[model samples]
Target: MADDYLVRIGKLIRDARQHRGWTQTQLAEALATSQSAVNRIERGNQNISLEMIARIGEALDSEIVSLGYSGPMHLRVVGGRRLSGSIDVKTSKNACVALLCASLLNKGRTVLRRVARIEEVYRLLEVLNSIGVRTRWINDGMDLEIAPPAHLDMEAIDADAARRTRSIIMFLGPLLHRLRQFKLPYAGGCDLGTRTIEPHMIALRRFGLDITATEGLYHAQVDRSIAPDRPIVLTERGDTVTENALLAAARHDGVTVIRNASSNYMVQDLCFFLEALGVRVDGIGTTTLTVHGVPAIDVDVDYSPSEDPVEAMSLLAAAVVTESELTIRRVPIEFL
Candidate 1:
């Protein structure tokens, strides 16, 4: 519905451009779109991205969206900044969510070191607290401590928070151990194509996890008696799917080696945390992972995940864009 309305506005923009006797190339140059894109919008064909809409509006010297409905733009420049100060890398968000979900495996307290104080973590923490996980911030919200939750308070879940992140799907891996059946809100992340939860369900099905998507949430049921008869191979080399598989395997009482695993940055961080919890993870930096899941795992572990290369790139980009030089230390070049 919203898309239809937006496309209608594209036509209006095209018509306006035409009324001014502008060629498709001329209009494209004005709107910063390629001639093909301008042609598509004029024909009511192309589905526009938000970035396109902004550029078009800027080119047309007209406002596609109403004036009152916009957030202020923000940009910061360090001005060729080279840092002499030593800055410690913050924990990875990917690892933190996986660790938080895995914490349910333990009946004791879980303390995470230097957790990122970003919006995404706060959303997961909200969902955790709603599910009866006792999480608190120490050292001014830098250090996070979460106590084992008796069970997830399913009804109290923050739907908005859960829906705002793709990591919410990871909860399924840990939740299956604690509940026979539960539902998780559908994932939300980059505005990319529809990513199926089937990979997660398929990998976990070996562990007796049965999930069905309805409306907008993933409905799941776990048959504790069912364990994988052999190795689990992921359908795609996705990062989150691998984490879900690891979290499930972490509590499975046997030697489970995950084949075709994604040795991504987040996965490595999770492996580090799992190792700290006494779970043996072989092939830490490779596609194949041999996980020796311990039946009983109770340990106070504080593991620091390295910095995000994406954020570091963004900082470096800010420098390059403004003709500045910036030194980003502790960049996990492995991920880069």
Candidate 2:
């Protein structure tokens, strides 16, 4: 059994090396080892230490082994330890992704301070990069700078990345204004069971957006003649739904009143971001949002979304459970 496991690990290492386009000799040079030793390691003829695996992973920039337990992790807690320290709340994942989608609305450079570096954000960034948008992590990966090209290559969008995140639906709002027609992969994320995108379609249709799902893709067409003449009511108060409506409204030339909007923390963050783009949004933190749309957004903006209230609450709960006195800083008090 141990030999089989070693062989599997060896095969993974060999595959990663080949993916990096490095020969065994090159890998040996990088690892300061002989090519024969490397060949033996790859053939499972020699045992490799965890330290060597980690070095190889770093050299190839691939996670050869996760460096943690392979099975389900079990944590045994021993009570009686008081936790008495200040914890600064990180930015919210929900807000970060919403803002990533909102970045497509701006023609000028957008700098988001202390954005959450989560998988969802990374997947969105991948999709953004596959298009013509230029995204970079600055401030030591704490901040994100997004700059959209004058013309986005919708054809070049990363379908694999798009399919990994359900947030891809948020693109409909921004893309509707940019492209008369485009196709996006079907939204996919956690296996939370078959959640419907019909609510999103219902909300966005008010902005003249029509979607047809065929062959695992959403074929979207925008009717330019259609504009929101009256208040647009959302079928559901979902965060992404409210965000999609706001994205469509941001570039409209007239005022857009969105009813039944979600005033959640993430939604509020998107509203604030839209405001920074020179789109006037009234009734933030309320169900009714009055968006004074702009014809175009072309201005550099810097905005920092508030910390995650959910994380703050989790810390608070931990302190309470441990009978500890802890200071959770930068909590979004409004959300809590």
The lDDT values for all models are: 0.76, 0.86
Residue clash pairs of candidate 1 = 80-325
Query: Which 10-residue window in model 2 sums to the lowest lDDT?
Result: 188-197
Candidate 1 lDDT by residue in tens digits, 227-320: 9888899998898889999988988899887998998888988888888888899999799998888777777767666677677666666656
Model 1: lDDT equals 0.76
lDDT per residue (tens digit) for residues 207-265 in model 2: 88988865557889999899989999888788888899999999998999999998898
Q: Candidate 2, 333: how far from true, in Å?
A: 2.6
**Per-prediction TM-score, please?**
0.70, 0.75
Error of 1 at 250 (Å): 0.7
Best by lDDT: 2
